[model samples]
Target: MAECLAIRSALSSALDLGIQFLSLKTDCQVLAKAISSKRTVVEVHGVISDIFFCISQLKGFTCSFILRAANVEVDTLAKAALASYLVIF
Candidate 1:
């Protein structure tokens, strides 16, 4: 569920930036497969539709799954962002 939301947020940001092409990677296999195969599970059906709508607006898009170990940098950045957000509050 979090992965689906993150993907939606990322896509929204990219579209806002007028990005026409994108290659998105997710460490969550289910989310990755959902987007790649254009099939939605019951858990993320609504979000998947939103994601597909965003994809239609782009000239090119690809979503793939990466091993969590290979996604260390993203995890680190997310943790740092969360820490900063907590401090702000």
Candidate 2:
């Protein structure tokens, strides 16, 4: 929840500054299910406490679901960032 809240806050800040029509892609099927339906189950609470917060922040954009393979570049960049953070510490 804390992690998701931080991301939601960051997204809110971006939107407040006029970010619009951005392309957001995700690879998590469960996440896709939640966003597409605008509803979640009890298990979703554990997975996405801040998802609704982020959804409210985006008023003019769309999010897409992509296969993890199709998101390899983003995956690699994220992995690199994680590795770099580890190395830095």
Candidate 3:
């Protein structure tokens, strides 16, 4: 559920930036598959719907899953950012 919200947030940011073409890579396979298939489980249905709506506004987009090992850098960066936010708060 958090992963879906994260993807939605990223997509929303890209859209806000007027990005026409975007490729989203996620380490969460289930969320990736849900986005690709357009069939989401109950807990994420609303966010998935929002994501599909966002995708419709884009000229081109691709969502895929990567191995967590390959996503370490991004994970580290996100964690660091969150930690900084916590410290600031």
Candidate that scores best on lDDT: 1
What TM-score, to 2 decimals, does candidate 1 have?
0.79
Q: What would the per-residue lDDT of candidate 2 be over residues 1-89, giving only the tens digit for each residue?
A: 22233334446677778885455576656565666676664654743556666666666656567899897776666466556556777
Q: Which ten residues in a row have the lowest lDDT in candidate 2?
A: 1-10
What CA root-mean-square deviation does each model show from the true structure?
3.5, 4.7, 3.3
Q: What order do candidates take by lDDT, descending?
A: 1, 3, 2
Q: What TM-score would candidate 2 get against the native?
A: 0.57
Better candidate number, 1 or 3, judged by TM-score: 1
Colliding residue pairs in candidate 2? none
lDDT of candidate 1 over 1-89, digit per residue (tens): 55666677778999999999999987888888888998888987897899999999999998889998999887566566556556777
Candidate 1 accuracy as lDDT: 0.82
Worst 10 residues of 1 by lDDT: 77-86
Best by TM-score: 1
Please give the RMSD of candidate 1 to the true structure: 3.5
For each candidate in turn, the TM-score is 0.79, 0.57, 0.78
Stretches of candidate 3 exceeding 4 Å from the true structure: 76-89
